[model samples]
Every structure is written in C-alpha cells, then in structure tokens.
Target: MTNRLTKTLLALAVAFAMPAVSFAQDTCSNRGDLDEQYCDDNHDLTADTPTDPKKLKTPNTLVFTFTPVEDPAVYDKIFKPFTDYLSQCTAKKVVFFQVQSNAAEIEAMRSGRLHVGGFSPGPTNFAVNIAGAVPFAVIGDANGYQGYTLNVIVRKDSAIQTMEDLKGKKVAHTAPSSNSGHMAPVALFPALGVTPDKDYKVLFSGKHDQSILGVNSGDYDAAAVASDVFDRMVERGVISADNFRVIWSSEKFPTQDFAYAHDLEPNFRDKMLQCFYDYRFTDELKKAFAGADRFYPINYKKDFEMVRFVARSAGESFNRAAYDKQNAGKK
Candidate 1:
C-alpha cells in the first residue's frame, strides 16, 4: 500500500471504532444484514419505516446530495435545476449537501441530517443495511435504467496489455465498497486469470475519476473504474478516450441509486418520490448524466439482486462490521 493509503486506513480504524448514536432497541424476527438499530420485518432486505408514528420524520427543509464520484462543485452546479424543481414540487426548502466521500454521505443520512441523495451501487448496499437508506429511483429514460460497465484501463502507451500483464503491477481500485471499481473486479477478475490482492497489490484511489487520472499520469499501472465515469471524463474533455486503452471490460451493472431516509413520513415520502418521478431532466442534466432524462423507479430487493450476488461472490458483506472496515478509508 502507498504511504497515504496506510495512513488513511489507520485513520479509518479509529473513526469507525466510535460508538453509533443510540436508538431504542426493538426486537424483530429478521434483521437480515442490517444494523441492529434497523429491522427488516417485511424481509425486503432494507430497513423498514418506523412502526411508531412518533419516530417518523416530517422535516421542514430537505437536504439532498449526489454520490461523490467526482468534484462536488461540478455536481452541485449540474444538479441545480433538479434541486430547484424538487424544492418547488415538495413545497420545502431544499439544500444541496456537498459530501466529501461515501462514508460521510452515509453517516449524514444515518444521523438524520440528509433527507435524500444518490448513492453509488456498492455503497448503496451499505447505506441500506446500516443507514436506513431506501433506494427508490435511478437515472434512466424510456428504454430502461441506465447501466455502466467495469473497464480495466491503462494508458495506450503502457506495457500492460492483458489481464495477465497486471501481475506485479500497481492496480487501482477506487474504494473497498465500490462495485466496478473494486468488488465486481474482485469477483470477476480471477476468471480472467488475475487475482487482485494475490497477483498484484491493490491500491485505493478513493474515486473512479482519481483512478482514471492516476493511470493516465503513471501514478498507477492500470485502474478498474466505472465506464460511465470514464465516459463522462472524456465528454468533458478532462481526458481523451484515445489516450487510454481498456484491457478488459465486464458486463453492464446498475448505476447509482437515488435513495431517501426510511424514517420519512409515508405521505411526505410518497409526495417526494412523486416529485422525483415526475421531473424530467433539463438538457444540461441529460448531457451530464450521459443522456439519462429521468429518475427511473426501482426496488432495492429486486433491482439490486445482481449487485448483492457480486458482493457475495467476492466474500463481501454490507453489515455493520463490513461497513466499518470498508468505509474508514473512504472519507
């Protein structure tokens, strides 16, 4: 591991060891992989809304955020139109919370500071299991939900040309909880004749953009990154597709999930969901999201089945223990 990464892991260990905020303990027949504070009474594999009416929230202002896939300032501007529409639609003050990392975003919601936000696929499982985040929508259009592939990228001039060539090289994985960036690659790469930690020491780049940039700058030999993020970088002229070659690519995986805190009042939650489902993306929003034009509805239990499968295949879990271990370096 890099010196920076070693220091980061140490910091994470300390941060994750802190006690979680206390909630009244209630017995549930099946909690599944959720934290002890949450219950999965319906067996949906997500936190259920609080049974006690007093526990439900009807906040005056709604705080929103997007996944920290790239520069927060860029997304704050790109999502301005949608946030405005959400405020008008829900008749509430909406504020965009610029979270620095996946761990911060999840904690904000878990503490009831964040009302709704978009979560990347891998961290979405963590958010659901530990933060009471209920995913309800994804970026898509008439055809179906938008998806992305795992692209193992190397600079066009690099000596690394195949999966086998990655042995003994520095390979970047965005974060421990990232799907395409880490988990999926772990589950799928071995069949390609390379094992992540065994064949090559894995390095955490913290985000897909960073991984792509690292590979381009020779900071790492290659990187496993989400295709959509790579495409977005190319579209914005941040990098040229011609400059990098994808040595390997996996099948398409689901994109980020737009989720809300499970404790929101039912009527208020339904109204807010309607706002998301009804609003059409502006031209700029469409352009930023790779042609996706709307928040396509989804179910966590059904839609995330494949994501869960990959996590399991990779010997990963989204329970509290796993969350604490994996997310420490994310922030």
Candidate 2:
C-alpha cells in the first residue's frame, strides 16, 4: 500500500511527465543547467531517461553510500542494518561503498558504480546538475523531515562575543560544498557584520568533526558547522556541548538527501524507493540520527531550493569546473 506521501509524489511525477521522446532527437538540448548527458523534457528540474534503450541499467548488485561527515567507518556500521534490509528486499547484493568526499560520491553515481546514496545538502545540486542523480528522500520518521542549522562555535572561554569578534581570527569551514559548513556562511555572514574571506581567511577543515575538534583544541578561533553533527559528537563524548559557545546560528536547513542514479530502469527505481520508505530505523539508528526514523519523501526542486539560492548568491554552480576548483585545494 502506498502511503500518503508516496501517493502524492507519484501523482506529481505523472503530472510532470512530458513527451520525452520528442526532445531526445536534440540530444539533451535546452537542459538548463543539467549536464549534457541528461534531458529535462518534463521541466521538472531533474534528469530524464536516455533515449537509447541500452543506456538504462538494472544491476544485480546495488551500491550505496552516505555523505562523508564523520568517520566513514562509523557510518558504515551505522547503516549496516539498513543495507541488510535493502539486500533482502531487492533480492540482490547491496553493498555500502565508503566515499571519502562529496566529489567522489557524485562521480561514482555518474559512472554507474553507485546505484543509490546520500548526498550532503550543498552538493545535492551538483549531484543533480552534473551527476544525473534524482533525490527522493531524507532521514525522517512520522515528523515529516530532518533538518539542521549552521552553528558558529568558539571555545566557551573565548573573548568572541559576536560575529564582529571573528575578524582577524582563524575560522574554519568544513568543506567548500557544505551548506552549513561553507556556503551558508558565505551567503548569510556578510549581512551579520562578518565577512568570511575578508574578515578572516577561510580554513578548510575537510569535515565537520575536524572543524569542531579544531575549535576544541584551539587550532582555530572558531568554526562553522552543522548543529546535528555537533550534537552527535557531544552525545558520543567526542566533544562536550558545554565546552563551546555559539556566536551565530542560522535557521534550519534540510539535512542530507538520498538519491538514485537517474538512468535506472523505471520499475527498479520504484522498487528501490519503496524499499527505503518501508524500512524503519532500529533503536540504535534512531538514537544516532537524533530520532529520525524512516526515509521520508521529498522533492528536490522544492526542498533544496534554498540551498541552491544560497549557492547562487555565493556565485557558485555545481558544474564540473566548479567541482574541480573546490577539490583542487584539498590537502
């Protein structure tokens, strides 16, 4: 039985269906910002099928990944229960492929090595534009969705009392493609009387845990990170919430997205999404997720619009050139 959210989503998909065959002759022309390998004939703001039948795929073994925030090994363990359920549901081997970065995860899906995965909020647009990923769900239970806020943290004893105090101090951002960690700061900070690159040179900490840990250890004067990751670290005793002071925090943004490679066979795609929606989080998984349960429905063009707005405001696009530029500075 389709749940209310799934039913509504299916209806929306049908309503958005276009005469895709008519547009195939142009070989993905007028795809807007999407990569040339895809077409958006439906104007649904996502990739459509390849005109060639041979381009569609339904692999016997499905690959899955989660966005790299903390230790990949930790998430590998955290997601094990879900993978086991997915394998049984699909009657195929499901394997969790550990990804070291957002770029690598998107590339894996683009190259057909990854079947489904979670993408961080900032890079979700990049995955849609450049990697042909179709986002469908996020971690949530009965409450509808999961969200996080951008938290600017400094040591509790630090003299920084306001955003202005960040000037001339070392400030860390998680990665170039992070919503709370980087892009939101670039977009929201200037209005608050602190400019990132001008007020202080941005330091890339590679991950949220690193940024928080850097602040805790005094490696940085302050750092911007997602509140959820910070809470998880505190719960796990990696850091204490009391040890830091939040100088600034932004409104909640949607957490990471779960998306599938766009070229999947229609039936396979439906079944894959159903499998995720039907599964409930285990007790430990719920606690780890801060109480989010099942994978809840979402529309990429709607749910991620704010993230795209922030990216655009920062003069950023998810194109290959932009992706390469960000990763080029990686240590």
**Model 1 Cα lDDT, one tens digit per residue, 210-262:** 99999999999999999999998988899999989999988888898899999
Using all chains and alpha carbons, the TM-scores for the candidates as numbered come to 0.91, 0.90
**lDDT to native, each model:** 0.93, 0.89
TM-score top scorer: 1
Listed per model in order, the count of residue pairs whose N, CA or C atoms clash below 3 Å is 0, 0
lDDT measured at residue 193 in model 1 versus the true structure, 0 to 100: 95
Report the alpha-carbon TM-score of model 2 versus the true structure. Answer: 0.90
